[model samples]
Target: MDKAYRFEGTYLQWLKEELTGWDRFPWALFGFGVGFQLAILLLNPINWIAVVSFIGIFFGMWCTVAMGAGGYDSEGNRVSSHAINGLLGSISVIAYVIINVSAGHYWSVLDQLVFLFLIDLPLLKNWRTWSGKSTEIKGLTKMGWLYVIVAILAAWFVLYYVGIYLHDTNPLWDALALAIGGTASWLCFRQYSTTYTLWLISDFVNVLLWFTALKDGYSQAALPMLAMTLFYTATAIVGKINWRPNKVQ
Candidate 1:
């Protein structure tokens, strides 16, 4: 807690910690996830928005890791509060959607725009400890249901615009992914353990979304999402296995 998970540690050390299961938060796996995205971005013929999304995801993931490791109470209960990560990540997704829509890549990003707007709640709260660290992670709260409602509305909106801006023939799955993905993101900001579970479902949908894009000639764009999906699957598994109640609670 004093050092915010000591993010400054050497790569070898981080790797060793992950391999040996010495680190509680799976920093090594998360780090690998980031690296995978970075590689895909570098190798692909991507635009600036893609790069921006990468930066957003990079900063968001690392910030979440830091915030998670940084926050705690006197009894050592892990804090669930955060702001910057949620903001950065949502913005990243927005940029991704905008670029994709403008480029006519697919309706996935366009469809996902609805949920992205709600992700700002975490930033609005800016929950932190008196020491300027994170606070204990709490349950889904009433907000979880709100996310569900928002997702549903977003899904409907996606379907409504399908014929207008989208031509996917069958965008049902993509819309489902966006609905769930947006909720999953919101859940993560709320520090709900269930976020990983929701994300697992979302990630699977994303796999389909990107794969569909690849089928439609967006290979470079799809690759990163695919790579991220694989890593997301891994992280979801790890997160669920390691989840626990607040130490203080």
Candidate 2:
């Protein structure tokens, strides 16, 4: 009886340790962010979704910073997997704003700018670390710089739309912004093998939808974007499961 009891206790302890590292907070935050962004996409009568998006974005960014600060794999590869993941997801929302704006449906440029400043500006302070020797601290490198450029273009795309919507200006800025952002996102896909690359691939698809919004309308692009996001969610799940840190012997 004593031997059986000891074996059961050992198994429980092992189970607890094994499950402890399965961080889910980042995923939850990202999921909510995506949902908020997608829900705001409208065509019948354009309305402000920024209020809800603001909440989602805040929580999402919080999760990213928290996870990046401590989430490491068994290999000691500090990729800030969760934080990067949230960043990727959040960028998609920013992408959508750009596309809509470019298509001439500007709503809240100030809000968008504030959101970007809050979530991304602090990251610039850590730029030097990307070149450092530490594997955990230096994951961004050139690829990270490219990612930042893409993010900027995306934000600019939104502002460009604001100009068009408010001032009735026909801007050639959309083409330029999309070209640069797409190229950077493509580079990210080429360089990384982790979930980060997959996120970029997903963003590439969103870029296509953005173009369609420019040509056809936001509704046309938005419906398809929603469907694609479902795939994005699935990909995130697959990545989370397969990329679990390989256990150390």
What is the C-alpha lDDT profile of model 2 across 146-192, one tens digit per residue? 77567756766765666566652233344333434444334333232
* Pairs of colliding residues, candidate 2: 101-161
Candidate whose lDDT is highest: 1
Query: What digit string (tens of lDDT, one per residue) describes model 1 on residues 37-153?
Result: 887787767787677657656654554343233234334544433234444456556656654564354545654454455445444333231122333434454676577667767
* RMSD (CA, Å), each prediction: 7.5, 15.3
Error of 2 at 97 (Å): 4.7
TM-scores for all candidates: the values are 0.60, 0.29
Which ten contiguous residues of candidate 2 have the minimum total lDDT? 129-138
CA displacement after TM-score superposition, residue 249 of candidate 1 (Å):
15
Candidate number with greatest TM-score: 1
* Backbone clash pairs in model 2 (N, Cα, C under 3 Å; residues 3+ apart or in different chains), count: 1
Native-to-model Cα distance after best TM-score fit, residue 19 in candidate 1, in Å: 21
**Which 10-residue span in candidate 1 carries the lowest summed lDDT?**
126-135
